[model samples]
Target: MIPSILPTYNRAPLSFVKGEGVWLQTEDGRRYLDLGAGIAVNALGHANPDLVDALTTQANALWHVSNLYQIPAQQKLADALVERTFADTCFFTNSGTEAMELVVKMARKYWHDQGQPERTRILTFEGAFHGRSSAAIAAVGTEKMTKGFGPLLSGFTQLPWGDHEALREAAAQADVGAILIEPVQGEGGIRPVPDQCLKGLRDLCDDIGALLIFDEVQCGMGRTGKLFAHEWAGVTPDIMMVAKGIGGGFPLGAVLATEAAAACMVAGTHGSTYGGNPLACAVGAKVMEIVASEDFLDGVRARSGRLRQGLEGLVASHPEVFEGVRGTGLMLGLKCKGAPADLVQAGYAEGVLTVPAADNVVRLLPPLNIAEAEIDEALSRLDRVAARVGSDAG
Candidate 1:
């Protein structure tokens, strides 16, 4: 029998009823350390007081005065993003998938307005996940993402990850209008693109007159110890998709673009009814105010270093289970010798939670504001989980 909700996800058996900071309380009252942070959505941790206050305050004042009229909260968030990053304008959305839709449309529309309508193709890389939307699935072009969805949206070319030669060859083509990639692949196993590679992508886009797009939905909002992962490379994308932590668990996403890139979007090119509602933008603004600060980012970097070092030591102590540690800031991943799902299951046994990603990796995306003591506790719990997994394997 089909469940009340769609059974699309292979959900874990655990049922969490409440969350506070980096911990979740199961329905039966068991507490579990949340290292995944709701897949990086709860950047400030579950039920962050500031975010809760912002949402409640905005909810009491106003909730849904759609894009039909001006919204102050939306304007405030847009201003903050513009001041903090490279965007000249921002379009809000309800999720990363909606942001992806705008990114594709904006990139192509720029060329169309410039009298180059044929330059419609956008280049993406393997192991790239933009979103699950038709355009996003088409952009990835992987059999895993596009198998059943046929007659997919055209004009996206998939390239091998880190293949500069192939990237050069593809970008040189006349029809290529843009290049989209995740600065650090979250679902592709928390792989960080080298700084030089990001710089090279920027140079390549400049040379070919193609826009550069970054999908920062998973690695932005200070998850990478920088405001955005691309900032570590000191390069800026012409268009960027941002979400996840930006709302501090509330659903909000945005497509930020340079004025030149967004010139063609005019008034009716794209929009959403529930996108930028007062409740969402209020929470997002608060998240931005906190996460974009130097003090907060410094804390994130410090915690990231400690977590990374601990993960390395953990891997060394349990070589039979773990292979290595990779990723930046709080978005770390543990490469497993066997299926990462097994490690995730072991984490459950140890009253810890992790997210399993591609390439046999168990992701550890704890709250960016996780305290030092919490870090130590998380490491201790992870050590126990590793020991149990290793013993079982032996």
Candidate 2:
């Protein structure tokens, strides 16, 4: 039978009936190590006890109260986020795409309210994946995702990634209002923007009066062993988009911004029907609570070092298959010399799940709280899969 859902995902012939921590269980009772963590959404892992309790508690008490009135859970979540990050205000949404919609609009609105309405041009880099929204496709405008999806949304400028000279030159343009970037491009293949480069971009944006937006939708929420990925570079964005792990697998997203950047976004100017609902806010607040602690984050860093070392060893032992490992914390990618898809398929046979990206990279995004034993298992699976891939390619 044909599926009812649209053919959007190139899904594998795998159906997981249940999951806990870093493992998934198929209906036939086969177990698989889940390194993708639902593409970095299951920050604390599937069916997390605390998250379940939070959702259940809210569900019984209140679910959806319209944004027409106050929602205390939403306020508490907003306050928690504001207290820890560079943002002075937090606006909730349903997904990364919605968060991005607000982000682009907020940037443009910032300039418009200041009487520079023509400053709508935003600078985006190559291989950037914001979301499938119209604004997102328009921002990238690349053949990969934006193909046949036009007359594309205008007012975006594309630039080569990591070209500092070009970055400065683009920022200096009169019509530019913002530069949107990911601190570590996840879908673009776990590419981490160097610290100095991020610093340079910050300075350029500050000098040119353009707002800096970090789309941390994939790399935030303690996935990078920090509250947000940009914190590693010690660079802050004027506006930040967060999702995925912040909801800990729930479909909740948020747009965070400096007080100055959000000044024009009055109550009536923007809102969501289901966003900031009591149910989602309660769950998100619980996620933020668990992920925002110093001790928890330190564990993430320790695990990251362990995982990175294991991956490096795999790269050394399988030179024909892998180049190196990239990315930070539990969010990592293995650069393969051959097709990443091939490696991913081979991984399935090894009873491991992974995510594929461009640049022939396979992503490994285990839950932030994955155990040392699970890390060892993932490394063993990678070792076996790498050997199989290398042999098959021969």
Highest lDDT: which candidate? Answer: 1
- Residue 125 lDDT (model 2): 98
Give per-model TM-scores: 0.99, 0.98
Model 2, global lDDT: 0.93
Model 2, 1-394: lDDT tens per residue?
6689987888899999999888899999999999999999999998999999999999999988789899999999999999999999999999999999999889989999999999999999998999998999999888877887888889998999877788778887899999999999999999999888888889988888889999999999999899999998898999999999988988899999999999999878898999988988999999999999999999999999999999999999999999999988888999999899999999989999999998999999999999999999999998999999999988
Candidate 1 residue-wise lDDT, 95-137, digit = tens: 9999999998999889999999999999998998988999999
Q: List where candidate 1 sits over 4 angstroms from the true fold.
A: none
Query: Per-prediction RMSD in angstroms?
Result: 0.7, 1.1
Among all windows of 10 consecutive residues in model 2, the one with the lowest summed lDDT is 162-171
Name the lDDT value of residue 53 in candidate 1. 95
